[model samples]
Target: MARPKDDDPDMFRIIVATDIHLGYMEKDPARGNDSLVSFEEILEIASKNNADFVLLGGDLFHENKPSRRTLHGCMALLRKYCMGDKPIQYEFLSDQSVNFDHCQFPTLNYDDPNLNISMPVLSIHGNHDDPTGQGNLCSLDILHTAGLVNYFGKTSNLEKIQLSPLLFQKGTTKVCLYGLGSVRDERLHRMFVHKNVTMLRPKENQEDWFNMFVVHQNRSKHSATNYIPEQFLDDFLDLIIWGHEHECRIDPEWNGIQNFYVSQPGSSVATSLSEGETVKKHIGLLQIKGKDFMMKKIPLETVRPFYMEDIVLGETSLNPDDHNVLKKVEAFCTEKVETLLDKAAMEHTGNRKQPTKALIRLRIDYTGFEPFSIHRFGQKFVDRVANPKDLVLFHRRKAGVKKEESGADNELLAKIRPQSLDSARVEDMVRDYFGQVEETSKLQLLTEKGMGDAVKEYVDKEEREAISELVKYQLQKTQDHLKVRNASEDRIDKEVTHYREERKKRKEEDEEVAEALKRAHSMRSQSEDHPCDDDRMSLDSDEESRTTRGRGRGRGSRSRGAKETTRGRGSRGGRGSRGGRGQMKEPVIATNGNRSILDAFASSSSSASQRSARGGNKRKTYSGMDMSDDDDVVTIDDEDPFDISSSSRKQKSQRKTTSRRGVAFDSDSDDDIIPLPKRRR
Candidate 1:
């Protein structure tokens, strides 16, 4: 509702300046004492134009309660130019355009004479000022001092005021102004109490006139789902000065209808606003001509912003050096310290004892640096630098810390506030919290030595289920491969067992063959008379038997000698001519394939060598040597009990040439194939 008796819109010239952010840390010591200097400049601009009243939309201080000296400087400036105390306020005024006699700043927040002078300054709170209904903090305290500001909207409680159906009245035009601002401690102006934050919600009974609604928040033109829907005031707003936006925009379309003007006056001081949130720094002046109101924008020049730099620490340079990265960093820190010190020195020059303009703040950000140097620098800079606005050390230093892991075994101990996972930083933060928590721990367990009730326990909630799932999957996928491996191992065991059995059978056959050959050789070597002395001589029993048999069967004894030569060679080799008298048996050994195949090759090979040796010149002792029985093995092959190729003559002949040996092949009659065996000494 708009009250017609309030103030006329057409008769008065209105200037809206907003978002001053006066105690801004970035602009301090550079912008003519403080950021409030821009406010004084605006007042001078208002006086030349003979404005009626000035409306400051919000955020007058970077801090809720400015520092005492910066606060006094602001009051002193407004008293001089904004009230009756200025040289231009009365000097160029033939028609005392504004009355400026009453003013107050000391204790009370009541109205003063300066409210009537120059253009009265009216203000509403923004987030930075966070106006509490209690005596915690307010812009009213500062505004009351110079008598330049009026109407401390009932901000003591987070409550909204209703207009009386009529606002300021002109000769025919009446302008209704509706004000809404942030309540105390609500984050970003959300969650205001229902009792203090709503106007006449009965939409049909909402007052009609030139309505001006001022609020300190994001423009409600974004999608309706993100922010609180009740905060949107789209009901018949003629001129809406959306105060919280820090960018200068006069978009008529942003209000969702024609003839709806939403004006954002940006900032009264040129300070860096939120770049990430996309709000620019600007101030707004409203110039009304007839039925139409025109707007002009003034940009507050920003002082140099806070410089942020990242220097990487390397393995080679992690240890601090004189001219290396550490030295450059030191020089940078020293320059920043000097810059802040110089700033403080330049303020309120030629003072009685202290400064009138007063200095406020300096901030430096240190990120991505090693902790050892940062700690040393933080201590040294604080001790050495003079007269700073406010010094904040943000980097991680061992700030009254406690060690997390206490032993050489590298065990991790839990701390209160974990660091940023950056080396030493998170540890440092944890250390700080640990010390605090440890103090609390001691107090809580003062009577006992136990850890008491303060320790937070560790539990692995996911381990059992995760292990079960993993094992189940593995069994499902790999069972077939496991079976294949078992089968391969079984085959290898069978092959090894077969080889050992074959080797034993071959060893027994070799012993019988050797024994038979020994008896046969003795029969061929001795005479029949030698057996007459068998009981009295050096002759072996088998040899005596063989010698007696030789006299009985001469051909049989000789054939036995040939068999001896065959067996005595490597495997079944015929003995080579002992004195070059006859063909000899050759040597043979197993390479691979069947054992029978090797025996056949050996038997055949021996036959070939015997033929060659019989053809040679040495044939003298052949008359007496009884190698006949040994020679009969070829006849045995033709009638052998074994059906294998080993005991067959045709197969033995087929194996005439073998890769098993380089023995040359030769053919001989069965008798000529094996040579006569000689007697051993």
Candidate 2:
């Protein structure tokens, strides 16, 4: 294949990487700065290559709530390398309001007149740095707010995802970059299967553009519904930049069924000491000219080399019954460690600077022998390896046991089949437990998936109030539903009582489930065929087939190359909107409830003519943005708990000046007093 010419004016050059995992083990002594150093190198690479922009797939930060030090390091790097006065060659043609709807400043950093940005950095959030909490903010949101990075692909409405690509044009070559930040795999899978995902195409000349999709989902199938199948993606896409999986498969692999090439740049830093991390890490320098593209894999030299190997002692001549068995095993392990150290030394022979230390993991299978002290063994190489504490792992194979004999073993076997090593998701475990129970006995108000999501949030993000908040939210929703149904006071009370009882019962059952899972984890099999699996869901072929066919049919039925425009924008709105720059629409603000904050502010200033024009009941438009119904308008008294004003005494006094859901005229000033909605009971 002929490569794109270096000085081609039409070519769009982009530096692509993913899963930088900044702040991963930042507290560690040996590998604390590994992620940051590699990330800096990526930026330097982009600068030296004179790339148009840097596109990160996801997982830019290892933690959803990264430490201040991590945030400072990331911000400093971006400021140092990305901010400049270099002229951007590409023309951004996408609607900024729709692409960066989550942000207050919808425009890209480079486009903003207040900031002087040269090398633009565009990124989505991965599972590690996905949004959480009441505000639904992520680490990238901070970077975006600071005008250091252009954050896109955030969908507040998970029920229906409308992917509006960021369209860019350089000379005659047009590129459409579509991004979807990390979504819960199962929910996203179901959405795709049900054909709820929509990819909004340009109004005209769509075939002339090279389309690229950047998604941070499970590319590798973990379970039936835990992964997004490549076939589910639109066939129009030219390239797919996959993230989340840490293996560095930077070479673009052709997906014949989907007719798109997938390039997984993988994690810049090794987050784990697994065998997959041993692959040479690289970031791709992608050049797109018209519809043709070429990917050049650029090696990352700052990454700490990780070497992993497994040895089966039983398969060797070593016998457990031998009197010198312990000494012999120790000698064998020492020899393996020395060999890995030599290999690590050999890896740094090139002009690249040597890393702090190499990471090594040796898995020993002492099937019929007693395990030795791993801590003592690791002390010998304390200065040699980054992870000395977990240098060696001892495994003992499980014997053929009957299901009836061991409850723990039976549960483990039932949950994890021999053919697959992927662990069941928290949601799956919750569903299985509920499925086994009688339908009448199962909790009615709280759903298994909802509880599962809450549990996962609590466990993974350390959000202490996740479970309590879910319980409260569910109860409130139930009460609202019953009230809407016009249930009697007695009936409502009875329903509430039943719900509480069921919740209590469910809590007790959850404890029992937790204990069983703990036991299963302890007695997990370590056989080569069924090694311990990570916290990922399993895959299903049935769901994949359903997703492929349903999505394919759905796409075929939609208008080809038709633009999806928001109301009041223009006749030819959305990405193709040629409306004057001065006519920029106000961003549609989303509140906690299905209410519009702007509607509340707009209601205070509505004139008699405006009211008459709205027919007193129709939805209103504010600054070319459609507002929600009056009933869904957020008012002062109904202040969001996450809002700073919720705890302010001055704000409370201001709200008390107006009546509930009533407008009052101020005698002192010309302004009309806006009534506040009553607080929820």
Candidate 3:
């Protein structure tokens, strides 16, 4: 109905709801949650709030075979709210009216233009309701032909009559309602066809025209579209309401203008079979105060709240203990139910999980039901609970945690919240989850070589040779590198440790020297103060007298003897200094030096162990000398080991000359051939 009124120039009113998965749980007769409570509630709120028009974003039904009860529920709800001037006959016959239910295949040839509450009801198809999946293909034809709703599920705009401008007055603001009744399906190749572009085109582009686009695609890339480039929602759009997922959320980030709004009204009911489903039931209420539209969220939990609390029923057998346990549980529930009824009202019904301040969305999960009458409990539980009309009983047949082939329960089973077991949509979620995981796994396998069973067999003969050659080259290189690295590291470590030890020793020696210097300074100062001053000592004690002038026969003579002794000490120190130069080259400098030389020879003799071991094994002469096999020992002997040194050569020549003169190193049966000393020990 895209006809704008010239009288009121500035504003238009619209209400948008998305992703109402109607007829979702009809087969779940045990739960008896066949009614689309969310959608029904939205319709009531929209009607009560006096919205100009309402939009169903998508997924009008979960399948093609929507039950007659579902159809009647939808039509009845729509008939009340979707019209401004509908016939009075369409209303309930009496205040104490019977709940109307539709017959199977209810005929609807009664579409008319002159009705008061008969505004166009636009709808879209969501992923769960689209073909190519477990969705209905003919949900639209059935819905449209029933005179229940107007929708767009075609590739080329099949219902231009509803989108036409003839449905509004000359002065009344017109809203060109367009709906992509069915969302996209990935299984179909898009040959690049355009997506559903709904425009609230004003009559001849009036500046007051507002577009309320209704759609059923994901805000992100979902399974609905297989195309690489997503259908960009960048046309002459004001606000595009979306559906598919069951969580009430709004994206204020769209279009950078803050004028675009989208909502997945969460489902039309509290009950969902989806995994990880959190029921945040929401609806958008738009206020048309001028053209500046204000949108506020109406969570269904506000008026008709949902309540789910844990009820632990002990052993439910007929035993006395079991009976007592059940009584205790019943007592607890009775107390809670009373408290809940205290806050509940006729319009505001409290369910298992109390939704005290959102929209009217009811959910009560009666888990741990024993062989007791939950029906009796439901009937007598609370007051003004829409008694029999709003109250619904559910019998949960929980399949115990799935076990593994080894009879061990799955690890994830513990992680799963028990509330998830109440939903049947978990299967769809699991399938999708596994599908994504499988695709990712496949990609990883294709890229990594070790993921396949026949990876070894898949290798070509030439590839094997190439790999082997690469490994051999790598091994050789690694060996060479390791040898050099090991030798360097070992040598550096030894040097570092040795330097640290030397530093420690030097520090200790310096400390000793400092102490000795301090002692010497003290002694020198005392001696200076008392030099030949026997009188100075006499002032403190009765001692010998002093002889200051030229040393007569007194304490002075003894002092002169002391000076002579000091002079003698100086002479001895000079002599000692002179002897140090000659001592280094002498073999008999001291027994300590001689002992050190003998020890070096002994160590050299013992170190011949390494030589024997090396000589035994096949010599692996690597390029670098760093070998993990430490058979090669470094022995510094008194005799020269480095024959290339100049001193060593000279010593060897002298030795050869001595040998010629029969100056042999004669040892009494301990004769061993040794290399010449590079430097004197």
**Model 2 Cα lDDT, one tens digit per residue, 1-681:** 248888799998999999999999999988888899899999999999999999999999998899999999999999999988899998999889999989978889998898988899999999989986546688999899999999999998867899999999999999999999998787788889889999999989979989999999987777787799999999999999999888888999999998889998988988776777888999999998988889999998878888989999988888899998998898889999999999898778353644857889999988887778899999999999988899998987777864565878778868852222223466667778888999687767776766776677667676655666567666675787677768787687567656656655554334332333333333332222353222111111111111222111112211244322112222212343332211122222333222233432344443334344434533233322343332112112223547676546434533542222232232222132232444554
Off by over 4 Å in 1: 1-12, 24-32, 84-116, 130-142, 156-166, 171-173, 184-208, 218-231, 244-253, 257-259, 270-280, 289-291, 301-681
Location of the lowest summed lDDT over 10 successive residues in candidate 3: 542-551
lDDT of 3 at 639: 28
- The local distance difference test score of each candidate is 0.41, 0.73, 0.41
Instruction: In model 2, state the lDDT of residue 668.
Output: 24
The lDDT, on a scale of 0 to 1, for candidate 3 is 0.41
RMSD of each: 42.3, 23.4, 37.3
lDDT of 3 by residue, 1-681 (tens): 123332243444456666566676566533234346566677767766655556666667665446687767777776666656533221111111111012123222223443444455656556544432111135655565555665453442222312221122213343333445443332122322333333334446455554555555444443444332223543455655666555566532355544354444555554443332444456776544323355667766422344433333332232334546556555655666555555444435354433333211123344554434566665663433433223333445476995554424566566544423223333244334445675435321111211111122113111122223333433343445446656465575454444435434443322222233334344445555554333332231111001101112222212333311111111112322211111111111122311232332233233344345434322112111222322221122232446568556555544533322212232222123232333333
Count of clashing residue pairs in every prediction: 32, 8, 43
Task: Indicate whether candidate 2 or candidate 3 has the larger lDDT.
Answer: 2
How close to the true structure is residue 672 of candidate 3, measured as C-alpha lDDT? 35
Candidate that scores best on TM-score: 2
Residue 523 error, candidate 3, Å: 99
